[model samples]
Target: MVGARTLAHLAATAFLTVAGVVATPTTTHADESSDPDAVSAALWLATEVDDNGGIPGMVGTPDWGLTIDALIALEATGADAETAQEITAALKSHVRDYNSYDAWGVPGQRIAGATAKLLYAAVITDSDAEAFGSYDLRQETLDLVAGPELGLEEGRVKDKVDAPSVDSSNTFGQSLAVLGLSRSGGVPQSIVDFLIDQQCSVGGFRLYPYAFGGGTVTGDCDEQGADAVLDPDSTSMAVQALYAAAEHDSAGALEAADKGAAWLASIQREDGSFGGSGPTEASNTNSTGLAGQALRAAGETAAADRAAAWVLDHQLTSANAAAASAELGAIAYNGESLAAAQTDGIALFQRDQWRRATPQALLALADVSLGEIGLVDVDPGPVDPQPTPSTPGPGAGGPNGQLPATGAPVLPLAALGIGAAGAGLILLRLSRKESTS
Candidate 1:
């Protein structure tokens, strides 16, 4: 009997031939040993990690945030258990650095997003969030929540340390806080409420509640009018958090998620790709992957599949194989990046962009949302089901609570295909149409 994987490979080959994907043929072949694209992408991220135990920032500094993202990607894909544990230990040692503006500080400037994200990592790993290393990440996250003195923004999550910092309190961070607290300690309704308030009357979420330079926490999405910029990335992140919140029965979270999904659907490009805000206004893998996951979470199957197809196009696989073996399975920043990588291996300066893009872009290929983190296994095994209705206790699930992986492993065509395109490129043109929502 032809194995299931082989059968899927044959079907995928047939689909590629019928669709007539355009690409330049190349002698380079995809690394077939790499089964799922998620694992391949996560392993590629592992290759980029340095002795400091994290991905590099501008000027070769260890970027704690990107390191956390890589860790999350690894855990989500169930790639390497030992590496995930190593990242956890490293981050735990740098808990103060990860959550604070300065390693040495008087008042101890804590970053709300960082704290929440760390807490989330602990929750997924079944580590003690209440006491991670010397810090109690769960309590610390709660401390970052705005108080009643802030009036309408009382429940909002804020850095409260230095406003000008990168990856500070924004819709993205707020979503992290919600997700971090969702399954373990449980999120407060008010914090969830604040996230809900971020939604515009037009159905999307903004990056920040305040103006770009202004840090007063003023500015309502509704009042922005012509200036109302709805970000696909931020909206998608918020939707991921809201889906988890909805899973927990947080009031109005599901509705807000539904509306956000609708806005994403409205903005999706003709080819099923998505764009980011401000500088990243063109079709890109990051936005498309994030939006695709949100759409899948919202039950938009066709939209999500379209996104997965677009991301596969940018991936360095057997289909669009790079000359170097190291570059395979590393997703590019965009189509241009993919094309450039085909001719010139990803440049040294360009590696950082590719590093950031791969993990997020892997989401579309994974077909799982960060909101549902730990719920599905990347390489799952048989497990006994839960007996009670209450949430799984710490370590009950592998990360969030390990359930058996659903569906078959994806065969990202950067491997082998049924038909021929060009010598050095393999662009996918799936006949799967945009389904009526």
Candidate 2:
């Protein structure tokens, strides 16, 4: 019920408290990029949720969509051996049946595209056979998710969904599909092409090409005639996929990504938190996690700094706080908003925690770290072996401290994403040569 302005003020106050310093007005701009350590911490916090997002087919009493989001963030961060290995282990146990619609035996078969999501992580991280299932299963799973016969639960029927309908609402699935196929090396280029084509023009992506609803109240898509405006969650996922794919170098991809990043920046609250669009009034931890990564990716460190600071400030230091809160694991933009909700708040520990793997947030943080430390020529694998000070072990520094910065931002000449406004013209011309390689 709180408006955006109130949310901003609330965030500013809360940030000042937890950050232990008042953020200068210049520090609040969208153009600033976050230091790698803050990005790492954000992703690190999100991974704690992934640790408990259930062990796949077993049905993790608590849902795992948010955990999955965090996991994707982790992957985007390009974490080292230890971090990746830990995530890989979790995926292996809970995601062995990569294609099961209700692998966890959950009520909603298509809530967050769980099947495609696990596969994305599996393929990217190279989880073992048992964890990822047979290659044939992988292909079949992709077919099921991408094929025409989309599944819709009969129980919900008209009340929740239509029959035999593809739950395109699975934004996570769509983006992960793109990420998995692109990373798999075995999947045909066409699948990747199809996924790319699904990107909405309005600087972000949606769950499906035809599926709608992304916090839009206009009852209409954007002026570009996009099927729908971008959702913060899906848009962040799309950026992750494109960045992984290095689509930024391709025609229109960079522009699209840049616009998507810009759109994300536009929605950030004054306090640096990002709220889910529409009725979801609270600021989403998952959304904040991914948005931080996207901004970090685009070299917008200032935005990342503010956003990451806000997330850290709001993190429920207590146990199970996010889980018990009415707003789920999502954080509010500021203290007043948090206080207003505390009257009915479940528990302190349950405040900042919510359901999600947050691999993407981790990936985002890792990427920022890699960018800062100049850790190029790296491959995806265990986070520790990757050789970072933050490798998380006896000898290595904690997840924070002593990370070397790369000195200067390397702005890709090519614009990001598929939007029209950002250097798209040049990128399209370059794509003619780039795609061939």
TM-score of 1: 0.76
- C-alpha TM-score for every candidate: 0.76, 0.53
Q: Candidate 2 on 21-91: residue-level lDDT in tens?
A: 12212112122233243334333434454344421211223223333333434444443345555655654
What value does the lDDT take at residue 115 in candidate 2?
A: 47
Name the regions of candidate 1 deviating beyond 4 angstroms.
1-35, 104-107, 162-168, 380-437
Q: How does candidate 1 score on lDDT?
A: 0.62
Worst 10 residues of 1 by lDDT: 428-437
TM match of model 2 to true structure = 0.53
In order, what lDDT does every prediction score? 0.62, 0.38
lDDT of 1 at 176: 78
